[model samples]
Target: MKRKLWLGAGLSAAASALAGIAAYAAHRLSGPTAALKRETLFAFTPFETGVDWEEVRFNSVDGLQIRAWWLGRPESKRVVIGCHGHRGRKDELLGIGSGLWRAGMNVLIFDFRGRGESDDSICSLAYHEVGDLHGAIKYVEARLPEAQIGVIGYSMGAAVSLLGSADQPAVKAVVADSSFAEMANLVDFALANRRLPPRPLRALADQITAQRYGYRFEAVRPIEALIRYGQRPLLVIHCTGDTVIPVVDAYDLYAAAQGPKELWIVEDMPHCGAYFADRPAYVKRVAEFFERYL
Candidate 1:
């Protein structure tokens, strides 16, 4: 009888431990974000290409200051905006932005709130980020009316580009790299990579994140936006060796894109590391898209 009682006690302890783990995982799924570190692994800049840039700032819909670097002549109406990924700063997009500017288009690369020089208090990942993108469009329009606007986004920014363009009629072109179909799927992918099963845990995470952020993850589907984008020109690129976001995701995005669209598969690249993996080819492809559409 004592042995049986001990066995029951052990099972109860195990159940309690498992429940505790699930709770922790759900909380982590909300994904706390911080500012990018003072340094980066790559050296991407416009100075190397010998172009003078202007400092610029604009306020997001939520009244947060978004900082950016603007290049190209004041009279130019062809503008390209570069959106950085999670925990990213503007300079990280210098390589791509410089290439666009060289191709005779204005370029603006900015920081999202809680990431770089922008507000550092909170980051709702891609949910709150769409507002920042809207503010950028407004800023450019106020300064250069009747301008043709294009956007290139990486990772989280990639998803935001597609989501934001759904409402902005002026967005002429978009290039998205290494974006997940949905935020919840991304959370599940991250957990699975760590050897954690993402079943009930992912559901809990979804609920917790929605309650905290005041929005549902189901509403941030970029794939849905691509279907509705309607002939504005979309270029979706994915790296083959990306473990964080399976390369197969690019196929779905490409297939969903209804209008003039192109999909490029980067060979043996990882995550958002495509541009750095092959700078020349990456720049040429992106520039060609904007050249055709913008």
Candidate 2:
């Protein structure tokens, strides 16, 4: 009788453990569910720059409808695709997009899959967001074949931009801002940001991630893409005081870049806060970089 009782308890415990793992995995896989709407994404739309803007949509490689805005400046031959940070919507990139527009470039600012007015889904971080960018490039090429194109991305968008540029030859130049070297460190940051302590569930998380995403987090690396980028006028930007993504990643990417590349480190600038620290310098450098390449 005691043996049977022990066996039942063990089975119950095993079932509970499996249940806990599945629950945690689902929550992590689901990611953040909230996102900004179109109006909110463009609250300051038609930016003070007075660029006429129109809402646009593009289908991702996987057929997800991506929400975007076209900031068209009359007779602008260059188009800069502005990619926002993780969990950030299209409107948040208006400042940067406007800067590019003022520099005599048109801007296409869009939301990644899970953020803003984009298709409803969980953020894949950069795993599949790369497809979103590829879709954007195709959309631009198909609609405006005569214009030169470039990409300026923030955080996750930066990583995806680099990855996309590796495959999209039409992307003339790239500006990757505050991007992570690998997705593993990003997972750690995500947990810490939520104040969740690291635990032994890492293996379970990895398994779950692989099962759902069809690739391990370690494989979603941007360094490989940067290495393949080979002397293509790449610009890597990072802030010294960025607590989210360490500055070391920037150094690694700069060292790994085999082509014409520039790395800019801002003192005391937080993550994605390069412009916030010194708007004038940021504007001048970025505009010049694009002008030099695109």
| Best-matching candidate per TM-score | 1
Residue 134 error for model 1, in Å?
Answer: 0.4
Flag regions of model 2 displaced more than 4 Å: 1-32, 35-42, 47-49, 188-199
Q: Which tens-of-lDDT digit does each residue in 108-199 have in candidate 1?
A: 99988766667654566577889999999999999889899998899889998999887899899999998877777777788788887777
lDDT of 1 at 288: 82
Span of ten consecutive residues with least summed lDDT in model 1 = 29-38
Q: Whole-model lDDT for model 1 versus the true structure?
A: 0.80
lDDT of 2: 0.80
